[model samples]
Target: MYYIVGMHIHIVPNRGSRPTILLRESYREGKKVKKRTMANLSHLPMHQVELLRAVFQGADLQPAGLG
Candidate 1:
């Protein structure tokens, strides 16, 4: 799930009504993990929309009713 500051932009993954963020990668102590570039989205006022755009870019992700 993408969170801008604090507001939830994308639903992440929903299970029965609860929203959860599933990370495909994990970090461990003493283990070096490849870190990717993290966009500093906290500075934006309209963060939710910006997060949504980031999540859906170049991907065919749409709501159930939207076509």
Candidate 2:
């Protein structure tokens, strides 16, 4: 069985291609651990990405406003 433990933002650098930032989560499938991408964050601005990283790291931040 696969169970997610936690999630984090990951940055993948390429030799000739543009870098990609992804939101990934750590999971355990049997005894081995693995990671899976939850979202692609490369399209978002750097500031927003930083905020999300902080939130994922357990930072205290205000809730988003409802529309």
Candidate 3:
């Protein structure tokens, strides 16, 4: 049985430094929610990372004049 809910971006905080940005997949088993890291997005630029996050969240960011 292969069942996965969705994927999303996750931020991991560091004690005295910048945090890590990760792309994770979420799944539910019984009554527990578990997440698995799919990729490490810490090396990407902040704007690019934000765009990817928005896409995952189903945001409609089309060009203003290209509608």
Best by TM-score: 3
Rank by lDDT (best first): 3, 2, 1
Count of clashing residue pairs in every prediction: 0, 0, 0
Q: Which pairs clash (backbone N, Cα, C closer than 3 Å) in model 3?
A: none
Q: What is candidate 2's lDDT per residue for 6-42, written digit by digit as tens?
A: 9999999979987899999998877898999999989
> Candidate 1: lDDT over CA atoms?
0.42
The residue pairs that clash in candidate 1, if any, are none
Local distance difference test values of all predictions, in order: 0.42, 0.90, 0.92
Decoy 2 TM-score against native: 0.78
lDDT-wise, the better of 1 and 3 is 3
| Predicted candidate 1 versus true structure: per-residue lDDT over 1-67, tens digit per residue | 4322222233244567644332232233354543222344433454454545556454466667888
What's the TM-score of every candidate structure?
0.22, 0.78, 0.81
What lDDT does candidate 1 reach at residue 52?
57
Which candidate leads the pack in lDDT?
3
Count backbone overlaps in model 3.
0
